[model samples]
Target: MLYFIWQKRGDKPLNKSQKAEDQSISYQDWQQFFQEIESKLLRWRRDLHQYPEVGWTEYRTTYWLGQELVQLGYKLSVGKEALVSKARMGVPEPEVLKQAENRALAEGVPLEWIKRMEGGHTGLVACWETGRPGPHFAFRFDIDALPIDEGKEDGHFPYQEGFRSRYRGQMHACAHDGHAAIGLGLASWIACFNKVLNGSYTLLFQPAEEGSRGAKAMVEKGWLDDVDYFVAGHIGLQPLNIGDVVATTSGFLATSKLNVFFHGKAAHAGVEPEQGKNALLAAATAALHLQAIPRHSQGATRLNVGKLVAGKGRNIIPDQAFMEIETRGETTELNRYMVREAKRIIQAAAHMYDVQLEIVEVGEGLGGESDKEWVDIVQKACRNAIYVQHVLPHLQAGGSEDATYMMRRVQERGGKATYMVFGTPLPAGHHHPCFDFDERVLMVAVETLGRCILQLT
Candidate 1:
């Protein structure tokens, strides 16, 4: 059941070369390719949207992608092989991970896959080696959802489309579901054209991207070490038409995330007020001082104590307190300054209250800029994209992305890397309860990256 789809007027020629080999997949061929799988891509996204999983808890999502990739003849690296275990940051508690794993198993993920992904080791790297002489290209697609409740209003697109999240307090509010689907679509295209391709392709279905957590582990495992080119992209970052694409992005902030705990001695406030050590007061004071850290002179710096919890009851002095904190800077050194200053304030507050303090760094990311060479390549590739109307040179991200770690790793080794942005109309901003993007962007991404691979290989 294939359709002879024709290119619309005003579209750029997909291949301008006179070579016969370049005509192997003509513009009509790509239209047919996309037509055949468009429904499958939508179904995949809806299925993923229905059952969202968060960082370090994406067993089902991993399995869902892995099973299909394996069937596509990719040599797979799952769990420990895909990411360095000790390098994983901001992992959930052991019990929480176990519960997620149990839920995955209950939901029909095979025992074999579960065993490989036990201990919260989720996500996989799928590789296709052509055994021909060429460059190695690595592309990353994050697959973790956020901890947000989906909107159930009649006007909400997901609700109207019957794809609202089924998991309570968990939703794919950041377009990661669409990312995973696009990755799979690209994998299918690559597998179909394996005979015509050269060199190798590695697709990283990365997880735990919500807190800037995931890429470091993959980078530490040396996944991007041999990559001649690395590319990663996000959908709908800006308010742009669905056909717009940004070839390169700038202004990624470096950041560090932490969890701080205070321990003190509890006592009856009426009978033993002097004997009590109030952990609550220690944490509250630290939160205040953490915000008061001197800003760096070199660049913009930010610090926030997002959450704080303490105390047992009204009559008893609190023996424990916990805080979630983060610091960000325009540069890595600037972020380091904020983190260092916040630590000093935390330690001082703990000492002043005579309470034991523990500070655990949960996540970190480095600022990065896209390579111009690769950016040019992406811009050229986007010209062949079926849905792409305009390819912007660059956009200011003004945020943090863990993919910077992989980009740096590749660039430091003398390879080229770039982060791309596929623009799409969004119902709501990212991480919001009603976040939803135009699904047409899925095929746009698949075509854009698929063309890049074709041009590179």
Candidate 2:
């Protein structure tokens, strides 16, 4: 029936004329419907990019998201409670516990910790029920910006035109602005065709994906309890020529972020040089040692010291130094090994330099493997929606994502998960100061996601 419907629509961008007798109205109707939503999707993308928000601190973003969902008639539950029950664990801090007790007295949240949580790192889930029973699907959209400055050039829009971010030193260099917009666009499009949906579908507008923190709270709260299939998309620079889509099959490196700090006594360099214990020397030695960590022959592994801060002035010996570093590998075991080796290097360096060393783990993400079933569905949907010479099977990605957490959890429950990489024409690479994407890919992403939801649900 689906094949016949697809043929009748005459909307196959990849394949032309099938027998006219085989054309189906249902497929044609959806094609036309999707085309109609393109303009709205574009607007949403631009609006989101114009006012990007950072992770967990998405107050205005969440408020706007909730308003949009409510306007679409979704019964809104604000904060974590609207999605799931609290985890069995209590507050991690004594100060938080006291605050929770006091906040519980107020009307907004039941506890102070919950209230604090409500203020920052807010998340929202919007559900649309079709009154028909089948598989339940969940789609996640990450809405966070990076802590980089925006690029201001003639080709760029507002930034070039002098409409930069009001909050300086913060910009959406990662293209999450595009991700959030696509999510809202998908929700609006799906809401219009709610009656035709096969089953229950939830739009999970997630926050703080940059730090891998937001999804844990939402999952523990039971937001993912009923979801049978999950999907998420990330916009990236087009490795290929313009107008091409890039999809990865496998190879995301599980990553761990650590902050290494070295402490020593400070002294005047010219007057009392012997009295100073230079922490900067220790930090620099460790940074070089980190690069020397051997790569595993079994899979890919890497270590990078991305940021470093040390010292006050040239005349004063540094009392403290800090390095922001990351380690990654193709598998969890390798990542663990890299982290262990990293710690040993830092400790050894500090010991040699007579400085106190501390290593703090900030974030960790597991590598993800693509589900064949979900990949097939995405490929089919994309092929049907646009012209393509070939559908790539699996593309390997080396970056880390919190979605890997969701993928692991779902796979443990025997559910399928897939992450898609949608191509955009960008002149610069991701995380670069000058990064930007061709907005046209926004439309392609919407159509791809919309069709996949229709076919899967």
Q: Judged by TM-score, which candidate is best?
A: 1
**What RMSD, rounded to one decimal, does every model reach?**
3.7, 7.2
Error of 2 at 185 (Å): 1.4
* Per-candidate TM-score against the hidden true structure: 0.94, 0.82
For 306-388, candidate 1 gives per-residue lDDT tens digits of 99999999999999999999999999889999999999999999999999999999999999899988667876665545666
Residue pairs in collision within model 1: none
Prediction 2 TM-score vs. true: 0.82
Error (Å) of candidate 2 at residue 362 is 1.1
Tens digit of lDDT per residue, candidate 2, span 197-266?
7787777787767755566666666656667887776886336422344444457688887888899999
lDDT (0-100) at residue 360 of candidate 1? 94
After superposition, which runs of candidate 1 have C-alpha atoms over 4 Å from their true positions?
1-22
In candidate 1, where is summed lDDT lowest over 10 consecutive residues?
A: 1-10
